[model samples]
Target: MSDKKLALVTGASRGIGFAIAERLIADGYRVVGTATSEAGAESLQTKLREHGDEHSALVLNISDSEQTEAALKALLSEYGTPFVVVNNAGITRDNLFLRLNEDDWNAVVNTNLTGVFRVCKALAKAMLKQKAGSIVNISSIIGTTGNGGQANYAAAKAGLEGFSRSLAQEIASRNITVNCVAPGFIQTDMTDVLPETQKEAILASIPGKRFGHVDDIAGAVAFLASEDARYITGQTIHVNGGMNMG
Candidate 1:
């Protein structure tokens, strides 16, 4: 086995997930990033090569139960139990509740909420045996402060946070921590396409008056995954630029 610690990051093809995987690599972990498709996995592997060969990418569609189980089994067999697992894989099905079809709601909830449960369930036993691990689920500010056209997305994210807390309580005695990192409007492809007027409105809402960078969220995840945060669990670290402060 490699001397470096192991970590798994889901939805790591691009955007926030990619940034988190890169950050973990820089922090001296042997990171295994998951993408939804073979093509996405290949692209992720290529992009992450600049960091070094210490990290790898694999195809793992968390939304599919069978695929998730098989992929995770192969992953654990090859790389051993990960000391850190970041549930960053999520999909957004944005639509008003009235117009949102069942398919869209199910897609978002299954992938974003239930998918996380699947990943955590698969790893929990192994981590329990190891008696040392950290689980960081990526949440969104919308989960806490509901959005206009994202009922499904919001509900899923909110459910994620609750699940994290419960899991944290269950595993804390074994030295495993479960926490969340809730990000506000981060500047990604999803937000980049917004109209200038909409962007301005969003910027005005943020106390920082600027969009958050991927690195901002990455930094928080890195912290939660580190020894420094070993005592911290069942809590959320918000990187929302004061957008939804309590």
Candidate 2:
């Protein structure tokens, strides 16, 4: 309705998702950001409103199949079809493989891997019909490097990258691209509480000598969503400040 193309970002209540939403809005896209709760959706709506009315927020629980289907149906009906879809919603349940329970593994896998499958499946048909779109899935360096206490999380992220590559190949004929942005050691509330010694150890591993900012990830997503990245598909853009360079 705003003449701007539509973009959808998941997990947009805070951190990298929020930054991606904001960056897309600034890029002149009508963005609909999603959160798992009404309060978070409302807060996101409020913050996004400061930018313009063309952007809004929704409550979407991607981990639930029925809910995800219903929410995506409503979104398609109301917003038409999104020109960009960013699968940035993910959850981590960290535990040593020996200590991890089935529930924890399932929870992480369901939310991180299967949940993305749901979102992409729900939108893929419409995108193919439109014959124009971009999909950017947020991944992590741990998916490649494999952290000690995050076996479940690592598997999910690794599966996600594989999924992106396969989907990109399937949709490239239709002029739609699917890709990933894998970040490493991003500076967020989760990392803020780490002890100074731990933080220093992390910094020492990065050639950049700093944790990445949300905007750094946002910039990568923005590029992948733009016309500039039209030829780039089925690739993972690493935004980890050279932390996991092969």
Candidate 3:
């Protein structure tokens, strides 16, 4: 309703996705977020009341093409084409390559890589019609640097950055920009699931002497999504507290 832009954040039920959605709403972007379940969608709505209904929630499995398409349609019909969209829906099935199954590989790729493709394909036309938009894909440091037991996840995320680069070029003439933010270890349920010894090892690796906070990653993403980053595209902004210079 205000002069602010509208944004859609996928996988916003919690963790980094929730942080991004919350910050976007606070920054005055009318936010619409998607979750994989009904309960998650309802929770998002409740969390969004502070931001008002100009921003809302949708429930859809981003990994499922049909469901993803339907969710985008519903959002567009209800709230119009968003000015910003963040593709943050992703899953991880960490295991050694020797033990990794086809299902594990497919699941990660479908959700992390192809799911983003689906959302963008669904939204890009609307964005083109508007003649402008900004998209930020949430990637992981493991994508670029690689990890021992995350071949599928790393591949999917790395593929995301590549996809974003190509799409950015195709849409730039239309005033659309695409970029990615790869976060290091950040406080989240997923990270909390790691064993204490592993957590300590991770912390020791970060030059900042600790794992990054959710807000740290959120701030980086917000910058990329803002007008201030209008001239930037097809770039990866790493928020890992100097873990990897690349």
Tell me, by lDDT, which candidate is best: 2
For model 3, which pairs clash?
none
- Candidate 2 per-residue C-alpha lDDT over 86-117 given as tens digits, one digit per residue, 9 for 90 to 100: 99999988888899999999999999999999
Q: Residue 44's C-alpha lDDT in candidate 3?
A: 88
Model 1 off-target regions past 4 Å? none
CA lDDT scores, all candidates in order:
0.94, 0.95, 0.90
Question: Considering every candidate listed, which one attains the maximal TM-score?
Answer: 2
Q: Where does the lowest 10-residue lDDT sum fall in candidate 1?
A: 46-55
Cα shift from native, residue 181, model 1 (Å): 0.2
TM-score, predicted candidate 1 vs. hidden true structure? 0.98
C-alpha TM-score for every candidate:
0.98, 0.99, 0.97
The positional error of residue 102 in candidate 3, measured at the CA in angstroms, is 0.3
- lDDT by residue (27-80, candidate 3, tens digit) is 988888889999989988888877786678889798899988988898888788
Candidate 2's error at 222, in angstroms?
A: 0.4
Tell me the RMSD of model 1 versus the true structure: 0.8
